[model samples]
Target: MPDPLGPLSTGILAEAERRWDLLTAADPSLRRAVDLQRGLIGRSVQLFETIRTTGVRAWPFNLDVGRLRSKLERGVPLLRDESWTLPVGPLTDALLDFCRMLEVSGAGASAAHISQAIDSKRLDAGSLLNASLARADCDIRDGAIQLGLAPDLLWLTAELAVSPYAYFLQRSLAASLPPDVLSTWDRGDCPFCGSWPALAERLVDRRVLRCSLCAAAWPAHSGCIYCHEHGDAFSSAAIDRARPERLLETCGACGGYLKALVSDRPLDFPLAAVEDLATGDLDAAAAARGFRRPALRKLLSAQTPRPS
Candidate 1:
């Protein structure tokens, strides 16, 4: 037997498949995007662990600024200089491959358009890199709009190409932040990348924030750390009480739902990404309950957030 689901990630994949079927049953458009993302999660984990670790890393702290406001405020972002350039050619090729994988899933037409665009040299690695970084600098949802991506294939083309670079970037930035500096950055967003966390892990008694883009992990305060909307306004998800390790925290004040994974041990970022996709039921349930990201976002807090 080939172990149909495999020993590793069998449970996560199974749950994700169930969630995918349920989510797409109501909104068919999510099917291809979800499937494509599922495929890339494994690749992303591998890439993050394999990228050049030594030469491409730096601490982004700035003394003149006093406190970190934005990631770009202090250091040069990847792809801006010759020393920090990404493997743009490989990234573009990967996106095309992911798009092709969507062909059998009734997204053949979308795949064809993306393929044609790439074949005609209408898209190049440098242009794609420029668009992805620019998009990350702004709102994530607005990436499709700002990048002028095709309407139907947001996940397959633009996001896929950008994902590898995001993983590589995460590893580089994660290495730079020291424990003391990380502890002082008591904010919902990553101190290193300034991007929102994809998930938070409870490492024994301490909880750490993991960046969605750069994969940087740092400690944080519990109870709606995202919007600072605690008390009666916040609530843990009612689903799967047996699995308390994973939770979807919804804050009524900001209507922002953050995915939280309470664990006794550290978890891998790549594996966490897989689990992030698997938690679509939580996302859908939150959406059905009118939970959403805050319209006017406030990702960071004042320099002092504790009893100091």
Candidate 2:
């Protein structure tokens, strides 16, 4: 019999099928958007795997940012057209809002500045928001704010970080990952640079954490992912212990929170990244109190992946 714990694991696929049915029934649009996002996220996961297993470390997880940015700049036009109406759905609407911000922010920004913003992770959040509002001919300053989002740049930038287009950009850059990288890797988190994770996941029985850049995933230690604090020595708790399906893995020492999903059996799905995106609300709730993914958000930070 095949190792059901592996990527092609049957348990994982069954879980995915079950959850997918529920998701599709609840919100077909969400399922569609997730399907699209999965491709991007999956490519990222593979890239990080390559970096770790290959031992062929290069600049920025062996990525060439300049070349990557140039491609994005050139491809933006192709990504849109007169008849290419933006997708409309819950997540798509959110994505539209984010794209508006990018368009607005990039309008007055020099190409060099735009590139710098992406690189420095200091892209103007306000400008992006304003621009997004402007494109829609709506006044964001007066728009109703909900779900902790303000009519400001910060909200817009956050949207961009998780945007589908950004995922596409990251995936495209990830193609540079060597085929043998995973064989050399010991863990995830942008195998090349060793940066803190954008998110952590529990896929069936494996614990995987991924880097915000270079899109890597590797096995995570049981203790605090950031400080390597392990066992009962470090404080940890789940939001609902009885409901194993949902968990909030928080480390009081470093103030990091990563969600976990417990299942009766293991899974075959790409559980780590999938779970992260699926449990976005948990991330939001954690961030509400100032707890975050415990990683730097600037482009310079992307230059070198940090240690978890």
Candidate 3:
């Protein structure tokens, strides 16, 4: 499948390969993770075309700067207003393809189990996709348990499949919104998808949060992103004193940690994962210190209604 974004996807994949080579060379243990990520990036590029040409429907947005401000003030993400109904045909195709890719990427028996379940009609791909979009964690967990699959693995695969669609919707929604609306978003979570930032990019003196899901970028708070704790509880340390540009920011109050890197600019969409992978050392450092990244924030809007 040719990449829909053509030259853009080509550049992104090339950059990803460059980074992966450096990361794996520095730490050979990252080989498996790098392989998985490489496959995912390639598949996502293909799916980007699939999503665009299939005419998927994005959730409608008001696009009023005032309404956007109100939503941001209340900690509601921009797309949280209405349930997004993804086209089942494209979504199902993406999910099945990802499942097969996972198998080829050495996901082991769990991947096979999911594939078998879907193939045998024991699992409904559309239902699983909708549940994931709705943030219906319990349903997903139950379905996984019933199918004798690892819940986390199943959820991760579903999330991976849904991500390209989310990316497409977010880009569309973002383009329609006023340019300055994102500036008013102060929450730790992504103003677009409510996912915690994969990492922070420090450009000059300001920190910008990069979304793990849709790869959206937004300004970050001065303090701890999880709890708004800016006191002494919020502190950072460089993993390598010689390289202060790469550091881990930890919030003692919430026991939450975020990896930050000084960069010339925000990372391109989807490439944020590459940065996150390259900084695995920071994640290890934070874990060694007993700090951790927080779970995905379930938006209040996720509970509104199921997608049609």
Query: Against the true structure, whose TM-score is highest?
Result: 3
Task: At residue 277, give the lDDT of candidate 1.
Answer: 69
Clashes of each: 1, 25, 0
| Candidate 2 runs further than 4 Å off | 1-188, 192-195, 212-215, 231-236, 263-274, 284-290, 297-308
Q: Which ten residues in a row have the lowest lDDT in candidate 3?
A: 299-308
User: Tens digit of lDDT per residue, candidate 1, span 1-308?
Assistant: 33211123456446545656775786787677677766766555344333433333443323323333233343323222223455565666666766676665667776766666566765454555544443333333343354454543743355555655665555543443343544445667655545567777877778787766555676777678776766999887646788676788888787788778876655444555655766677778779888875432233322211100
lDDT of 3 by residue, 102-203 (tens): 888777778888878877878888778766665556678877887788798888888777777777877777766677888777888888777788898999
Return whichever of 1 and 3 wins on TM-score: 3
Clashing pairs in 3: none
lDDT of 3: 0.78
TM-score per model over all chains: 0.67, 0.42, 0.88
* Candidate with the greatest lDDT versus the true structure: 3
